[model samples]
Target: MAPTRAVAATQMIEVDRLDRLLGAIYDGPTESPPWNTALQQMREALSAAHVTLMLRPPSSESHGVMINTGQVTSQGVESYETHFFALDPFVRLPEGEVVTAEELIGSQQWLKSAMYQEYLKPLDIRHLLGADIYTKEGIECRLRITRSDDAEAFSAEDKALVKLLLPHLKRSIRLHAKLDYLECDRQLFAGAVNRMLVGMVTFAQDGSILELNQEAQRILAEKDGIVRSGTGIALSSNHENRDLQRMIRQALTGGPVEEPVEGPSVVEAMSVTRPSGRAKLGIVVRTIPLGEFTGAKQRPAAAVFLRDPESSGTQPSQEVVRRLFGLTRMEAALALLLAEGLTLDEAAEKLNVRRNTARTHLRSIFCKTGVTRQTMLVRMLLNSVISLG
Candidate 1:
């Protein structure tokens, strides 16, 4: 037998090999990836009979993810997890225990599983070796490595190799967990951008559309709103509000840009052309270099800021009110402020109106709704779920 010192050195060497294989973490994983490269690299490095990447949030069911698998059938990776793995016995093991393939084969749990015998037997998979790890978010993760029946169950050497390799697996898994989370957040943010009440159209500095939120698109479609494409936005259809166009132009020049119309301002209007147009078009704009939010700088072309009439420094728009009240757009918007516990003055601040003006709108609201008081209106509107806001 080798001396204890020699054994320790050999183990150290093996661990180092695994560490080198794992190597450095590159800059954050890109949201989009070419799937084939990830799969091939991991498969070659692990030398495993089978490997799976998994992520499970706390209080939710777990999933197995393989990059190549995620690409071919975006839905396949998650299917077995939802349907099959809930009953997987091996998953219950503590973190870091390497259950050898034979051990898994010999388990009472394995023999007892009708799914395993009838299903896995035909596939020639007779043994499984697995490693479980945890993330900062407290999800339990495990990779199930398998071997065919013709091959002897993974030997002690296999367990040692796996043990040597586990840390790399853990680091990679953690990175994947973070990448998945960031992706979820990115999708959620994009959803928010697409749903905002204002008619927003953002682009790269080069002037390509990154996103035009739903409300913006509707306004653009309706001709109720004006938006410029690759060239520029229209000032106005009537006298042509040159000042507003100038603001957009200034923002395009890569500086801060804003045009404010005084509902009742202390200062008089100042413009190159003193044109009197009722309901002036006011635009707040900014320039976005390529890849402002996205990693690659070439993704976006500029950000065109728009605040249309329904969003005219007012309380939440009809769309927001609709979502909050679960009511039709017009009715929800009509009742929104009162239903949300905002008194006339608070509503005025949100709507950028005087208290008296807000009171006038409230009277109109009462006439339309048949409700005399705010408290009564709120109670009636929020009976089932008060927290929708």
Candidate 2:
């Protein structure tokens, strides 16, 4: 076969493999994919000192396949999994790019972490080689290989294996993201419909109801009275009205028509104290495009904003957390500083404590609140209260 034909055949074979991988991934619908065995097998497949996978872009914080034949983990694999993945410089790595561990540290990003001291030095993780399986939209999926103390950097064969497997990895990622997105969309739609105050009814120009919120149903029911059947608020009476229904007909006929809705009434309100005692009602219609909604119908959307002025009082002082957590006054002050996004060492200096001592107190604070990290503690504290002062 010609070189061009050979390349085409290779591309076709890879595409078929990718499709099969995606089909398998999508077929297993669990949120936490059962990749434990798969990862272990892949590490064995790729010849390296140690191999690992880092899922990227949205960052589920996984440090995948590990080969420890060289005694890489001293304490336990779980310890590394629990603590180190959060601080791993390997996860944020861009797609199609390779990294060396030394280069990672020399870049100055790793010096801020306790991880550098905790893992890298003790385990003797030397050279690192990794690649990102890039998506068209630039989301990176990290695949990594770690070299041990004795081993040189990854060899050419290792890189070739990664290149060979890139297509399969990319397909799994796309299917996983699609499932994730659809799930999120379902949740968001349910939440929005449940919370909306105004009675919403979306209709095709032909008068078919596409969607409605609960509140909208209630308001419509009030006008139409009790419904023994689903037909109570059926098609608009003006559907047959040539002039008025023309708008709905025109809308459903092609895509959309900008015309007013002629309902009996719609609730509108003005200040009760005004001399005129203004009462408003309308059958206002708005034009929409067919491309707006995901389905066949035109999308009619509205944002409902509600404010409860009564219970919007400020939170209790931060002193409460200080008292509860047994924090020193300075530590409590530092907690407030961290809640505002200050660093631990910055908080330490501001509170006049040594960094190590402040770190101890911070850990204690995290333990007391059931928070495992500074970021979590800061977020929780911010939600409840303000500065102690």
Candidate 3:
């Protein structure tokens, strides 16, 4: 074949590999330890000893994150992060350009650098190809590829290949960061709701349960008032179930009004009776607008929140209560005991303090909380966001 034809054939082969590389890159957001597969593919395609991705650069405060594929030792990784990271001289290259250590600095100069001599040399990594990626969201990361001392230097084609992958890698990394943030937010909200002792159940349009929190699972497992019936949920009372089912259907249909609205009237609320003669469960069925919820094969159509009135409310921590009400630790303890329905003398006896001291704390709590009455103090503390912490 002619030189042009030979180059064309080589390009065609690389084009096939590019498709797989792109697939791995885009699929990275969904992967656990994201971009592992993509990095592995890049390593194989480039015939490198190791491929390291610096998701976050090391700082004085943090060691940051590093993901690698191919032969890598834990000790080497730790040393790089803890000691040699600051000494690295080949970092912060022109964004998106692939350059080798030798190209960045002279071969002799690269070997003489502290980072190379003290770190990379011992690891058997002589040839280094690096690219820096910056996203619109202000994420800065590095892609580092290494080869052994005897290995051939990175060629022009290798540089070109890395340059081609940069855009896809940048976008995928941004997507992964966004997804990670969203997941963290979801956990934060879920934890707050669980701490408040509320049961949450996400339902599909078909009335099947999509997701349920820990509290909901516990409530259903007890089967006092509500229980899981197949993929759906059920109440012990037949009449209550009918009403609950009606509310579910209405919520799934977006109610009589097509447009979304805000307020307590937008959703239906009811009291569910338990066969065990316990207090009624507060049930609120609310519609989830179709347009608001995106992605997932089975989207949540309605949200069912169950609040057990008989169950003791979340016990607020004394420290949190103290911080919230600006009261001393003793006053905070007395306030909690009062919130739990204990009389002043009874609280004093339990606390092993004199009645006069208890009265002094109560008076101080009232002054700090701006509530003159004991009932108001109890209500204020119970309604506070201290438990959500």
Candidate 4:
């Protein structure tokens, strides 16, 4: 039958509240809206004393993220987690459907069950309405509204209201999941770059510093030859500074080159002398192409890599070398020493092994890494991304 005018007016008020709830869900910078506020709002709208949102169904084996109104005490929540979760009938219901305890099992049958006698009875919970907002890939997110024994059973209008809001809740869950995954990827990328041994600095089109890894900060802090001058980096030698600035300008303005240059157009390598007259610092400037126009305010135009010859930079971890090339501990150590610019005799002396033994280890490393010569092996190791860490 059609609803009376008063009933329709009341339903419209509920609809407005649902609209506000959705706005709260998607409006904030957080992965999801503050559930305490939203769930309280839901409780009032549904005329229930308590509401809860669970990212996954509770089980004895796993605990999931849960937010609830104050109606459920900490002890109650713990008890449910420990024992009553396995007794929940709502968890066994079909996914993506909004249902109530009465609809799932008759009221009399539920009252007789141990879940009610031992669990719900103590908490005074007599009615529950539930819906699964997300169910896929072994994950389940659900919402539940509960009422005490003195309250009436949930009406059809209440079920309809929750059902209407299900799609919006599902979309919000998907968005939060995607944001979480992207955040994890960002953390991993930042961690790998920060741990690199080579000093890496990225520059904008205007020669402004964009970003620098930890090693770059260390190198600049030394202030031996290269240091930060205003927003851009500067070299002690005027000639090398001019050359670096010119190369940066060319890289930013020239765009990407289709053909390879004879020797140094693509990459410019130079040496900067230290004030203390120690080993010179090697610097390589390479262009970073803007792949496609994205209308970003700041884009990287060039990358500067600084290598301190005396600082023992960019040494691959022996464990990583062993795992990658299937070399034993001794062979991996010998290979790493060679990559560090040591000759066979020097490496043997450092390792306290005979020259013949070093040679044998060197041959084993070559066989594992599929290189025929020491120069090729060193080049491969230096070029590998493992060297960065």
Candidate 5:
């Protein structure tokens, strides 16, 4: 084949591999292929013995995901991470640019370096093609493909292949980071909701249940007046059931007319009667506006907050209270006592502190929480989701 035709054929093959790698990277949040597997495939395509992706490169503390087809051992990788990374010359290369080891430090200089003598020589690593593909917020992601002592040096074609892959690798890393952040946020939100004393349930526009917090699950498990039926919840009383369904419809449809012409009258508080002469459950249904950024039609339209007045309130974690209010341990304890409906003097006695000291702590708590009165402070603390934990 002519040189141009050969180059075209090689380019076509690399493109096919790139497409496969891109597909794997984009496969849903939970389903992306492992970095090592993708790197290994690229290793084979580039005819290199080793491929490594270093995150936050040049920092000795930074780590790397490496795939080696040669004699690189786990201990060698550990040594590289623990020590040799500080001496890695390619890490300091210009961001978003691709270069070879020889280009960065000529063969003579690389061979003379202590890094090569003490580390690379032992692993039989000789040639390397690398690129700093991504850089942001002091973090740099570098890709390196290495050849062994007996293997041929990286040619222009090999460099071209890596250059072609740089942008995709950058994009895939960013996508993975974003998905990780979203997952973390979701877990935090779910955890906070699950720990709440108030039972909470979110519903779609059609009144189908979207999600229920742990408290809601517990309430439904009791099988009192309210129960879940298929995807939707049900109330025992025909009148109450109809009322709930109507309220849900109103909330979904942006509230009722003649009730309030103000902003949105999408809030309704009702008492749900239970069987066996049990106390009625208090329920507040409120519309959950689908924000502009959330354009999905299937998003939740309303949230129902259920409160069983007979049930004891869950104690707010002291550590959480301190963190939220920027209070000391003593102040947090005082706040919790007040939240439990204790008067300032009663709380002071309970905490074994002098009334004057308790008064001082209360003032500090007021300043930190931005609430002036004891009633307002108690109300704010009770309504906060932190108490759920």
Candidate 6:
């Protein structure tokens, strides 16, 4: 009876350890450096001299991503990736199964291998436990844990712990990878929008600003026509403010009540007056399509696009335009000026060239672009993909 009670107590302790391990693994995706804390926790739990998560395995084409928590130096990691990665024998183990160096290659062979004699032996690491995780999302990563040469070999319990963690680790890695991809896409589109100098403002159902890009921040900071008003935005004129508010309400509530809704959204546009008397700000309001189960409280419900007529200096890169249209440097510059609403004479003066030289370049541009008129050439250049560069 006494022996059975002791065994039950040991099981309870193991359960508690497993719980802590599980917590770290699941929360790994939200960490700042994603999985750094979880890797550190794993190293402590396994009593490892070093633990490495190979998010990508090194190849001839790429160095790969690696996260380490232990006694290894950055130089040592670089050396392994550059030279010793190819010689490593304990890799490509049975997927989803925890394995040791001795189990994969005999202890004698492992010690005699070049990877050990040159790399592992220098680090004083002798014992190795590893697992390869292959997720359904086509992600493949490796977990490597090592102990010093003098330390005892990994126990059966250690192998079991890692085996239990493999599945959760795979899921967390998949989640982190998906989030990373989405963030990259968001940055790409946001950067393009900023390059176009378009001010974008998104709103919640309660009319609070949910997200505003860099250009939007600049426009609101100026406070010429549209300004940040408490949680929402306001126009300089009271009449325009009322109209803006009405448009916002319609966008939030799925468009005007009198119209038959054709789709999930509605579009409305108006020009807002400025107190500074520069130019009117063009405002476009549109509803964002809601998901079947999405709640609107703090989520993005509507978007406002603000275009300032006075902010006309922004245009596509000169080099990109030159390459895209196969134009000479002067031709590209002249086309850009024309796209900015400049007359041919004004463009030539800006370029410090004679009117005849500007006319010749314009003719060349028209010939290359297959446009017969100046207006068509200007429209074509404005609509080209050079702005995305």
TM-scores for every predicted model = 0.54, 0.35, 0.90, 0.68, 0.68, 0.87
* TM-score: the better of candidates 1 and 2: 1
Q: Across residues 12-59, which tens digit of lDDT does each residue of candidate 6 receive?
A: 346777677778888987886678888897898888998899999987
Higher lDDT: candidate 4 or 6?
A: 6
lDDT of 1: 0.53
Output the number of the lDDT-best candidate.
Answer: 3
Per-residue CA lDDT of model 5 for 103-173, tens digit only, reads 88887888888788899888888887888865473446777788888988877677666666677677777
List, residue by residue over 57-119, the lDDT tens digit for candidate 1: 212343444333212233433445455454455565567778853375567768668646655
Q: Ten consecutive residues with minimal summed lDDT in candidate 5?
A: 25-34
Candidate 2 minimal-lDDT segment of 10 residues: 302-311
Kindly report which residue stretches of model 1 are placed more than 4 angstroms away from their true locations once superposed. 1-37, 44-49, 57-87, 104-115, 152-169, 176-196, 205-209, 219-228, 231-281, 287-302, 310-389
Which segments of model 2 are wrong by more than 4 Å? 1-15, 21-82, 86-95, 98-129, 133-196, 203-210, 217-250, 254-287, 292-389
lDDT of 6 at 302: 90
Worst 10 residues of 3 by lDDT: 1-10
How far does residue 89 in candidate 6 sit from its true spot (Å)?
2.3
Which clashing pairs does model 4 show?
none
Which regions in candidate 5 have their CA more than 4 angstroms from the true location? 1-16, 27-40, 47-50, 58-77, 121-124, 135-139, 148-150, 175-228, 235-302, 307-314, 317-335, 342-389
**Cα TM-score of candidate 4:** 0.68
- CA-lDDT, candidates in order: 0.53, 0.52, 0.87, 0.78, 0.78, 0.86
TM-score of 1: 0.54
TM-score pick, better of 4 and 6: 6
Superposition-based RMSD of candidate 3 using all C-alpha atoms, in angstroms = 3.5
lDDT by residue (tens digit), candidate 2, 1-389: 44453254345345655454345434433534433334444455443556554454222466443423333454656666667667676655555545555465663555445565677656676556667676775555566666666866665445555555566667766766677789899667755444423344456544555665665555445433212124113222333223323433443444233444464222221111112222321222334444643574344422211111111223335577688667776667777778656799888888888999998888777776788988888778756534222
